[model samples]
Target: MKRILLVVLLGLISHFNFAQNPTGDWYGNLEVQPGVILPLVFHISEAEGIYSGTLDSPDQKAFDIPITNVTYTDTNLSIAITDMRLTYEGVVRSNALIEGTFKQSGLTIPLQLTREAVAIEAPNRPQEPQAPFPYTVQEITFDNKEANATFSGTITLPKVVFKGKKKLPAVILISGSGPQDRNEELLGHKPFLVIADYLTRNGIAVLRYDDRGTAASTGEFTGATSADFATDAQAAFDFLKTHPDIDASKIGFAGHSEGGLIAPMVAATNKEVAFIALLAGVGQPGDELLMDQGYLIGKAQGFDDEMLRKNRIAQEMMFTTVKEHYGDTEKIKEKLTIYLENALEQNPEMIPEGSSKEAMIKREINTLTSDWFQYLIITDPRPTLEKVTCPVLAINGSLDLQVPSQKNLTNIEESVKKGGNTDVTTVEFPNLNHLFQTTTTGSPSEYAILEETFSPDALKVLSEWIIEKTK
Candidate 1:
């Protein structure tokens, strides 16, 4: 998210005798992207003349994260969250103002802290179901014995019972890559919750749960990869099959983004899956897909052709190094360091101001060689999609930049068809973004600003297809 720092026009300077101490709530907005804004607040308290505090990322749902170290002397204020690898350095420009730079990983963005609490209005989501919903919503828990993970989530069933007649068809919702909650909440929009409500209203049962180590789920998420998450989805499917009201033969999955990649992963090996709906799923190899993503997003952000080319080259170097040295982390790190060093030598600007070359290389190595990235870059989705014989509905928006609709959707359809399974449908909706929200440009900058969580047309397509498939 991109945020602009609000300038405090009050030109009042405080006397040295009555300086404003770095104590109390200091609020600021971080423009993470070109147009996206993430608001952060630091609550500093002084005890025995020593500084300590907590941090809040309001939009990201991370609250009260302890600030490991706080150093304030004269007009300088520095805060560090060692666990999160975040740091902030600021100058107390005025009694009520602190001009600072928020640094995390390797990215740095300007932040203007103010004494007054800034009000951030939540995006209006008319589609978010109000209470008195038309279905039965139950807070539930299921266990993944393989991961030794216990997941907490919600299951919404239609009000009508089908005891002795036909059992209700159900779908398990799988979220994209991240620490997603049951609702797969992002940018104030809960697409899974909205989808669950809609499907349940139309007589299909829906189960959605938090990811491992997120919300109520118990497991270590940091080191887990997509292969590990598939077990969790399998657990949800197994749990639903055991439910008296759910049709064991009709259970399926609806996954978005990375979740889209995961749906096929489970279905490919599990014949019990009746069908799967891939929401902007990954069909190409992870490296190629990510390269395309970077190019498209860069173009949307108005990056020059030269810059885009340079970025793509850098990405290729990183991806190739990782793919070539998939299992050997040490080799991967060594090669990545060399590549980064060479790139930095060619362009000193590669290293951000105030950050050392060593620090930049380390951050790059850690991120590029992560368990998830390593698996993703080297792993191909075509083989997985080809193995999925179950009925499939792969859909994406024409304007989706993250996963370019044409290339991915085409690859998905072709791969599935090559497996000699004709029971597949793929649709590319116009004017919709990766989240399927109708937008002028598919840039992520528009996700928070757009009111529509999931398009009515898209929702209807998903619900109707699942109903028809179950019947």
Candidate 2:
């Protein structure tokens, strides 16, 4: 009887080990909000007891997100990738149920997974039309030792009718803040496509691609800084000059938002660039801009001057603290933990009640703060503008709240003048928001609802300017 019992126990233990491996397909549903079900499918595997898989989000139309370093011990499972890390501490009962919480982006959200007998299929959607550029889109790849990765992008050009035809002028489109697709436009806007179409139609080639680590490109986007992005832009410019259809002498850059900053960096380095266009680019450093943004957001939400002042102080303190201890992460974290507690006790109203300090700190750190903010606060775009020997067109919308046009464009104009670049032109479109949408009131909320395509006026102005410059 004792021998039989031991055999049964060993069999049970082996079964449990096999069940917990988390290999094969696992289907789950995410509750983003009440009544909102986001279907998720994960293909999990184990390599030396580490969990690895790809996640597919049906609701987001996102698929094949590579997940690595996944591990499960008893009821607890955790996964970590380069930028995203998630831990699931829950039970797997009867070899089917996986109920737990998934921690990501500093917030812990509930997640449930179950082994499905049938395979889950994501909803099918029609593909977007290929770019209408006359020239074939070519893939360009380059290595950046600073970012420690190889970055790649697509270069679209005008079709060459014959050889020795004057080399076509080109522009490199830089994306804004966020994980932008190669086009740099989402939500049906397809701004890159629209811009590429227009520019290529006007005999100008354009290069636009997924910001490093997005789509087919390599590298970690979340961990990168503006200077890192500038390196990628430089690589793109270098690639363009080598193309047979491109005119090495007339190349320029047109960047939007953060991309705008990158444009100047490339132009500053490459004197061969003929011109540059700052399309709603930031003129000030990131930390200052963030403070301004917070204040504006507070004001828009009807916060009084005193409240705004207090919040600004808190933000500034946070920036200084983070910068001071950037390299010493352990000390920075310890100080931040203490500082956050004190901050909450002193100014409970600054952050929402019941919000986790850990979550806030996580959100505040990473590339956005550590790298981008640090670079922005220190490096003045004006130096790049001054270094630029090419003509420049800086456009901003009067209603843009993200990078307030009044201050940014004014700074640009002043900087260009100081740099002695007389060819610089600045334009502000009234009632247009950061995305260049003309609206009754320029607000971010309006962007989701309005889809008029790239502002025709803006496109016309851009095309005309390019034509005149290339001519």
Candidate 3:
């Protein structure tokens, strides 16, 4: 449950009379959240008086994103990536400086562009394996007939194949949330790639794929719920069962974040699933998990008690309304609208500085009633875990704010045990954030800055556990 940031854009200086050559590279830092900063670079070029450019978010490992529109007149400059619904409007303050506002979704943040490049050192991910490796890697695709979706992925087979012994045990790596590629790449780190490499090197086969409607996979991701993603994971499991190199009896799921939720859902009814390793998986109801997520992250980020209280009130009301009127879009919207109207009446500060109260209410209602939001807010994972009889390993970072360790881990073990399944193991790694990276405050703002991709101790724990289970 990622926290949403909404704030009004501040005023910018007036346009100057002199025109600055907006060519070459322009750099800036985007204050995406309160404490998170994403460094952006715009590579602009002029062709016969027509300007075109590309944007790069280096921290996110994104590069060469097309800038569909660019207009430079006098001292005013504007650029838009229509596909991303991202726009930047600025006034050239000098030959080397431009003050602007970066707007995406419904939130606006101030951004300043400058000619001097910001020094962003590449993150050091020692765990990420290089090519020409010891394992056999293959690019592949599997189809989900139910979803009518084709998933593109990489399958790594250990070099040490069993001649007369048992077949290779395999696990499908599932990503958390968002439009993730096969690597589960984020913040310049490829956790899946590293995991696949380590496990394959340790003689366990690994299959990691892009989510449906993400990257090379074919399907619509938007409006799809966790249930839909479970079908996709099931499709992956089915594919591995028929593969020549994989042992059908030893196949399992290793999911991170939301993927953790999907793993239990798949294993609940599918007795064939060998085991499941949940990484920062949620054990509580979706609504409760989200409320805790908001509160924990807010507190970690130093949000005032009053602000946190209001946010909790807003989230609680919205989630409760959605759950009560589950599927009744009109009723949910009406209830949320009224609730927000009352909230804003009591706390005028809830309204964004430059936004109208009605507009804010409408936006909040629309988000809370959205298809994915509704599904996430209403789903509970404990019941699914209770039905799962397979071996379960639920692990989390003690400092993780996204899915706090103690609450979720306890629920996971108890739920599985309550169903008469005793093959459950849970561990809480201290000082680690959501991604398993050792951190100070465990704030997401620290994710990109810190270089250690996936913690080596975590990798060792995961690989050793899988080996023991498979053996």
Candidate 4:
């Protein structure tokens, strides 16, 4: 399981006065956890009077995020990011160094920045939509009474001239885990945005939204689990069902990763969900998925078998601890801590720097006890897939390491077909990563550097399958 790390605004020094104009790529590393270094890049540029720049976390695959309010007076430098409620303050040590602290979500970490390069080239995403899009785009809002929250999203309809008010088939796009914007923006690539554009251009109506408590949506993001997010998707379905231009019988759901799991959860319970398209969705229980993820990713990263075995054992024990302490949140944390500490004592190298066994155990405890992880560990999509009688399409990238393509696709298809759902289709595209982007190595780190967002072939398959089902 990955430790939860917050992304803070990367700062750059622009010489407005005595300070040497450090207008270039400044690089730093944050110890997100023991031995794990997250690379952060800040590109500073000076035009006239405006200090405009962008931030990129190469490790996270997030790039060109706008950093605002850049003001630096000599050694005293302060950068503020209003969107994330974060600020970075530090001192410029010389012509080449800046030492500072990154503050976000009430957590602070020391960061030392050095001039990495003169300039860094941004990733090329030519698939991103330009002006004069061929789809009719409209911003819309819908309310989910169960969570007492309102969601904001965009609906894209094919631009073809219809004979009167045609009832077009529609699909609601659900993003993977984490708080995502309407486009499911990640690493410099907006996969959902590309997919929505592709589907809408192909004459399929599409709805994609910001997660509750993310972007323009309201409610708490930290405490809500995947099931809670499913309700929001259901609400989107309800809204689409009543749209004046949408066909009630052709409305469907297209979910990615965790969103794929949620698609079945909603589809199984709500008969109105006509179909579902799962993209890199998991078919096993949440806890098992985590353990598998750790093993595979560790293997790819060149971790020894012994190290991976220890990881798996710790994961299994953690799951057991949580299961045993189910509803007792406080006690669960305590039990999980003891469990992990014991595991770490047995394996010393597993402990990260700047973090003792106790600290590592505490971090794991916090994550395992959260509403999301707690719910995720126990939630199984197999039963829900079995109950989903609607036409289903499950696709995974051959290079997808997070959700192994062969295992998950086979299991998901089997589960659906076992339920007597004969219309299920599963496909795995070669050389594509979790985001369906063509890559050399399907590593998560490769996600941002790759210029291609969503694979054209994947988009074609998804849009065609969705269109065929809606028909």
lDDT of the structure predicted as candidate 1: 0.88
Instruction: Kindly report which residue stretches of model 1 are placed more than 4 angstroms away from their true locations once superposed.
Output: 1-19, 23-25, 29-37, 43-55, 62-73, 78-117, 161-165
Across 181-253, the per-residue lDDT of candidate 3 in tens digits comes to: 9999997789899999999999899999999888899998888888999999999999999989899999999
Which 10 consecutive residues of model 2 have the lowest summed lDDT?
120-129
Q: What is the lDDT of candidate 2?
A: 0.72
Where model 2 places Cα greater than 4 Å from the true spot, the runs are 1-135, 139-148, 160-165, 300-307, 323-331, 365-369
lDDT of every model, 2 decimals: 0.88, 0.72, 0.87, 0.83
> How many residue pairs clash per model?
5, 3, 0, 3
Q: Residue-wise lDDT of candidate 4 within 1-471, one digit each (tens)?
A: 133222221123333236566577788876544434567887877777566678887644467887866776666667765554456787878768888998764458898889873233455789998869987899999999999999999999887733554689899999999888998988667888899888888889999999998889998888898989999999999998888878898898999999999999999999888899999988988888888888888887778999898889888988978877777899897787766767778787886533456656756777789888888888878888999989999999998889989989999999999999989999999999889989877888666667799999999999888877766
Task: Please give the TM-score that candidate 1 achieves against the real structure.
Answer: 0.87
- Order of candidate numbers by lDDT, starting with the best: 1, 3, 4, 2
Model 2 clash pairs are 51-70, 182-209, 182-210
Spell out the clash pairs found in candidate 1: 1-33, 1-36, 2-36, 2-37, 3-31
In candidate 1, what are the lDDT values of residues 1-471, reduced to their tens digit?
123222222222335425677799999978777556788888999999899999988678788988878998878999876545678999987768999888875678899999987776655899999999878888889999888899999999898754454679999999988899998889889999899998898889999999999999998888788999998999999899998878899999999999999999999999999999999999999999999999999899887898889989999989998988898999998888888988988877656554566767877788888898898898789999999999999999999999999999999999999998899999999999999999999998889878899998899999999988988
* Top candidate, metric TM-score: 1
Q: Arrange candidates by TM-score, highest first: which order? A: 1, 3, 4, 2
Error of 1 at 181 (Å): 0.4
